[model samples]
Target: MRNASDLPPEAAEASASGVERRARWLLVLLAGLLVASAAYLLYARGVFEPTQTLVLVADDAEGVSVGMDLTFSGFPIGRVRRIELGGDGYARILVDVARRDAHWLRESSVFTMERGLVGGTRLRAYTGVLEGPLLPDGAQRQVLRGDALADLPRMVNAARELLEQLKAMTDPDAPLNASLREVRQLLQKANGRDGVLGVLMGNEADRTRVTAALDDVRRLLQRLQGVADRADALVQRTDQRVFGAQGLADDVQASAREARDLLVGLRATLQRVDGVLAEVHGIAVNTRSATQDLDALRVEVEATLRRVDGMILDIQRRWPFSRDAEVKLP
Candidate 1:
């Protein structure tokens, strides 16, 4: 190894070429890496890709920032590149959505800015139907916000009202307390000897009166059962006297049967009398044909007497005359 200053200026430069060339090569590699890193960053930011623009208008831009991701279905599809005030004093967010992901957005898609309790603001897209018409480039849409912090005042107010209602209900002077006291009294009454009836009657006197009335009703029902039993026994005795084998009803039935037989005999005698009457009528005609004098009349009278005697005989044959039979004196 020679001294670095031994050669000429140009030669001296060449003599230390190993370390110098290595350092130069290292710097070139570092520069290439830096350029590659910059290209990668630009690609990631979608600066070099073809993109469609969408403008979102909102009332407030509290948590929105440039370079925020616009997510669709939990995947990033666009980036918010600018935020500014519009001519109408509304916030405008200009977003750059890649061409490939632009198809995911629809004309009916809803855009929103939401800030959670812990995270930064997020831009979101909701496409209810993927089959709808595609969202046009450079379209302006309204942004809806559902910021957790923004809703805090309303939530606090609702919570405060609820607490007030709860406190009012728990207060000693509230109607709920009165109802509870009434329920407690009712429960105590229900636990008494009268049970649920005591609670319904509300006082001891009324409950006692109701219990006495129940006892009276029970006694009345028992008396009615005894009366029914006595009535049943009387009916049995009457049945034995009127309808048993050697009872009054049997004698009455025998009398009725004899009376029916007498009536039948009387009806048969009446039929014989009618037949005799027809014969007498024929005899009266014969007498009128024979003579209109007393002789022929005497013959007709004899024939009529014979027919009447036959009728009498038939009556006797049907039913013999009793000893109490009477002959009327004409």
Candidate 2:
């Protein structure tokens, strides 16, 4: 064998040619691998597949961006490829859907763009009926927008206007403030010693007069009560004097009983005297020989008359009704 440094020129050239060929083969393999990887990524992205185009129109595309996915039931069915301002001063969003997912877009499908508090804007599609016809190619549809932050300015403006109105009403020269001052004055008057009377009368002197009148009425009522008590006591004493035991009623009753007994005794005595007179008349009519008896009878008769006179004197002393003691003979 020849030494390596002593190798033939043809052998060295052959070895160099082999190395060049291996290096070229390695370069070609790497290039082929890079192309395959790029093709596979494109195929995965659906660049090679057929698709349907849809155009969405909106008033504003504030958060909507290109390449945003259009979803149905949380699954991505299409992507936003472009956004442009239309001639009618509206935003237009272009979308492309793979042919396999294009059936999810129907003729009556609805599309919307919603911005949330947590994430970027989202595009959504809704189909109410699956039995409807499929959406056509390059169809233009209206997009509805729901922005949570949109209504804040109008609500804030309304609240600010309400606050301004409240401030105006509460100012020092406002009607409400004037009314409050008047009410405060009324309350102060009502809190006086005469209370509501002071507020109504508008003068302290008048309130004092009213208080004095009330005091006089109360004193008058006390005086009346004292007079009533005295009257009641007087009436009770009068009743005791008129109707109680050994009172005026008893004295009058005793006097009436005594007078009746006296009248009855006088009547009996007068009857006896009348009987005696009748006997004397009968004797005078029967016998003229009875003259002596008549004379004796005259003496007895005089005695009886004297006794009747003494009885009259006793009656005048006992009863004393009349001063004239005349006894008429009939």
Q: Using Cα atoms with residue i matched to residue i, what is each candidate's TM-score against the true structure?
A: 0.62, 0.46
Global lDDT scores for all candidate models? 0.91, 0.90
For model 1 the TM-score comes to 0.62
Report how far off residue 326 is in candidate 2 (Å): 61
lDDT of 1 by residue, 1-330 (tens): 777777689887776787889999999999999999999999877899999999999999888888899999899999988999989999999999999999999999999999899989999999999999999999999999998897899999999999999999999999999999999988887887779998888788998999999999999999999999999999999899999988989999999999999999999999999999999999988888566587878999999999987777666666656564433325
* Model 2 C-alpha lDDT per residue in residues 147-213, reported as the tens digit of each score: 7667778889999999999999999999999999999989987886768988887888998999899
Our tally of clashes for model 1 stands at 0
Lowest summed lDDT window (length 10), candidate 2: 320-329
**What stretches of model 1 exceed 4 Å from their correct place?**
1-13, 212-330
Residue 35 C-alpha lDDT in model 2:
100
